[model samples]
Target chain A: MSYFSDIYKGIKTLLTGMSVTGKYFLTSRKGAITQQYPDNRATLKMFDRFRGEVIMPHNENNEHRCTGCQKCEIICPNGTIEIIWDRGIDEETGKKKKKIDQFVYHLSMCTMCALCIDVCPTDAIIWGQNFENSVYDRTKLTRVLNEPESKLMPGVED
Target chain B: MALREKNNKPNSLKTNNLELGTQNMKPETINSNFKSEEYQINMGPQHPATHGVLNLLLTIDGETIKKVEPDLGYIHRSIEKMCERDSYQQIVHLTDRMDYLSSNINNEAVCLAVENALELEIPERVKVIRTIIGELTRISSHCLWWGVMGMDVGALSTFFYGFRDREMLNDIFEETCGARLTMNYNVPGGLMLDIHPNFVKRVKKFVTHFKTKIPEYDRLLTENVIFQKRTKGVGVLSKEDAISFGVSGPVARASGYSCDVRKYHPYSALDKVTFNESLKTEGDTFARYQVRIQELWESLSIVEQLIDNIPEGEYRVKTNAVIKLPKGEFFQKVETARGEFCVYIISTGTKSPYRLKFRSPGFSNLSVLNHIAVGGKIGDLVAILATLDLVIPDIDR
Candidate 1:
């Protein structure tokens, strides 16, 4: 009786597990859910919150918001940021507004961390959701986010 | 000779092992027992349960492990040296590659270390986001562990379930941070970006769904009588052994050692979050399971508590992009789902770190195998190894 009982118990246990898998494979709602990645690219939505690459954007008055405080430059643990300052007199309150002659961002060495953008006082920089950061040349990653000739405000938010 | 043999109950029937708490009876004759040469066994660098690239020289007599030595340096990526070449902000992303499974925790640990060194203040919004992401990482890591642990016990279906649930979190992470496994979201002062518009609602839905599925996992693996039989008393790591081995996180707490970094030393608003350290005193495979399952519930609760209350503030601290750390060494530890993982940084006061060392939990957990595997059957060895949840690259790195 003991030998027959042991064998029966083992078989019962085995079937119990198989039944769970069978349940999932047959009837679970999520069983049919599969992400067809490459083919589904058309309907795939890349979220706006993604922090991919840094870009210095300008707004009305053709003004740049960066004051060249260099907070983003100092907080970066790696030496991936480069900034050149252009000093000019402002007509608003007769105060000097520092504009960036060129703001260089090296994407190859950038860890895609949003720290620099976090520390920027003015919303001068924002991470561009560009996943195609690959380049044949390393120098191509060193982009001037702010052009020297773009009409820029000293420290005002563009 | 009779008195000496009478007092000691030998662990094995044939082995002449006289070493116990003490040889109680005075030996009338000492020359009767002869020591034999030890046998050699190879473990890892590729073994399924070696938990990465760790190769251990296990000297054994039959199944009893005698002398065990861990051979390291197989997956050594000179991240510390590489940090010195980059800026302060750039190094935060590299930390993600250390423990690829719990990438958020890895990034936070390194970022916090750099922040402490520079004395950078983080915003309120970033803190809540960090906590949410950290808990999500913990849940994902535990999901992987649960599946692997089930596979160790010869239960295959749970692995599919574990991966099925965890993939959803990976999707969320990929949408938010651009990568699934190595998320470089943490910075010196705060998070890369604020939580997504629908992050809170989606997280709530995920938690609601996850809770409903917990009982299914229990029915599939935890409540099984065979799993209980194999794990209840096998590989019992006592409270004392856990301390001496420097084991932390769930591995140490499972053995009744209350050593949680989040509790003892809270970092990144961990104290503000309401959560209890999951514990069990058995120090065996079953105890480990109990700690992890309880932890999953606690992590879900932590996420449930803070997802909505996230205050609106700046997502990062105001800092420069090309940064330098003051001349000093910065060391920090974070509790990954596995255990305590330490990142040691030697700063030459430059943009990149001078020397960095990652003291990972899997490395130490895998080292204790020879002590536990002795006397247990080979089949139990798989159970023991799977219970440890060894990740090869983590061990290799």
Candidate 2:
């Protein structure tokens, strides 16, 4: 009697388990959790605070806020930021001051830790929400943030 | 390892003779028998059951495993060594890669360690938010483990069911901290930022939804006869063995060891909440499975209790841009989903740590595998390994 009861219990329990999966199987089409990633690219939206990449904000006059203070460069643990500055005369004051030549950013080495962004004094750099950072070439990752012929914004003095 | 092989050879020979003598087996039948010699096989730095790049050298007689030797160090990034070069705030993110399933908890452990050393008081909001997020991370980690456990034991549907619930938590994490897996939300003083405006509402919705979904998990896998047969009375670890092996979390609790870190050493709003420490006296694979399933309920209760009462205040405390810890040794332990994760730091009054060490739970938990898995069948071994939930990067680091 016990042997028969054991077999009966086993089958019952196994069926209970299968029923759960069967319910999902029937409703899978309506309850699918997966996103078709590349196909849904047009509708994909990142969070506003997403830390994708670093970018320097350029204004209408092609003037940026970077004073080349090298705080971001110093705070970066991986040496991802390099500020190439040369001394030049200030346009408004006509005094000898440091002007940014190039702000070389190594995207390949960046860990996206946001340490540099947190320590920035002039708010020169901010996180860009563009997460598609894949590149075919390594050299393409080492980007110069400031565009050519761009200068410091007036009233931005260190 | 050599002595065990010598001992098994005689046992196999005795079985071989018994096979031949019974029913007077023919010579050709004896020669063709697959159970000849005890063979040694390596199951990945790449195999699926290992869960990560964990190479397990299994010595077996036919399908029965005689020994399991875990070969580690494949994913070792020398994170502790790297922490010596990184600042106190920077070390928080390094913990994200260790037991990545509970990265929030790992980050919190380091932050708490530094905060305690500094003796800085954090606001109530930070404590409550940290506790809620920490429990959420635990539930998410266990959800992944439950799915992987079913898949390892030949059930595939549990993976989909588990991930279905996990995606909700991932969405909440994305809204609050931007990154889904390694949020890096915890800093030395408080969180990286305040909780999202919709955080409480989303969490309440998830809690209600998940409460109903858990029973379905029980029906799908817990009560299944196949799952019970695969897990029950398999990989039995005695209470004494659990302690001696230094196993914590679900593995130790299943053995009736009374080793819940949250209950014993409450940290950050854990004392304010009321929840049972799920425990089972039976130390088999099924008991381990039961412990985690029960904990999911407890985690839900914890989140529900705190979601409505998040105090409003400064989410972050003002600290120096460059934090320099006073020269001394500091240690802090927190309960991760797997077990108790600990961080030990020695600072030389510098911006970076002088020496840093992580007492990851997976390391001690993985050490017990060879002891329990010696005499189990290959199928049972998979069941045992799944219940152990060995995350290779955690062990390696």
Q: What docking class should model 2 receive?
A: medium
Model 1 misplaced regions, further than 4 Å: A1-16, A28-31, A48-158, B1-43, B57-69, B327-331, B343-357, B395-397
DockQ of candidate 1 (2 decimals) = 0.21
> What is model 2's DockQ versus the real complex?
0.64
For every candidate, what share of the true interface contacts is present? 0.34, 0.66
Give the Å shift of residue A13 in candidate 2.
3.0
Residue B32 lDDT in candidate 2: 75
lDDT of each residue in B92-158, candidate 2, tens digit only: 8888889999999999999999899989989999999999999999999999999999999998888
| Candidate 1 structure quality by residue, lDDT tens digits, A1-158 | 97787667666765666677788878877655567887987786666756678887776656677878888887665667888887877778787867678888888778655667767877788877767678888888888887657865644653
Q: After best superposition, candidate 2 residue A20: deviation in angstroms?
A: 2.5
The global C-alpha lDDT for each of the candidates, from Candidate 1 onward, is 0.77, 0.90
First chain TM-score, candidate 1: 0.72
Q: Please give, for residues B1-397, the per-residue lDDT of candidate 1 as tens digits.
A: 5645664765553434443424534463343334555787777778766556777677776666666667778887776667667766667777776778888998888888888888887777887888889999999999988987887777877878899889879878977776678878887777776666767777888898899878778877777767777888988899998888877778789899998888888787688888898989999989988898999999999888888798887998766655677888888988887788887888887777778778888777867776776777656676777777766566656
Q: Candidate 1: what lDDT?
A: 0.77
At residue A156, candidate 2 shows an lDDT of 76
Question: How many residue pairs clash (N, CA or C atoms closer than 3 angstroms) in each of the candidate models, in the order given?
Answer: 29, 0
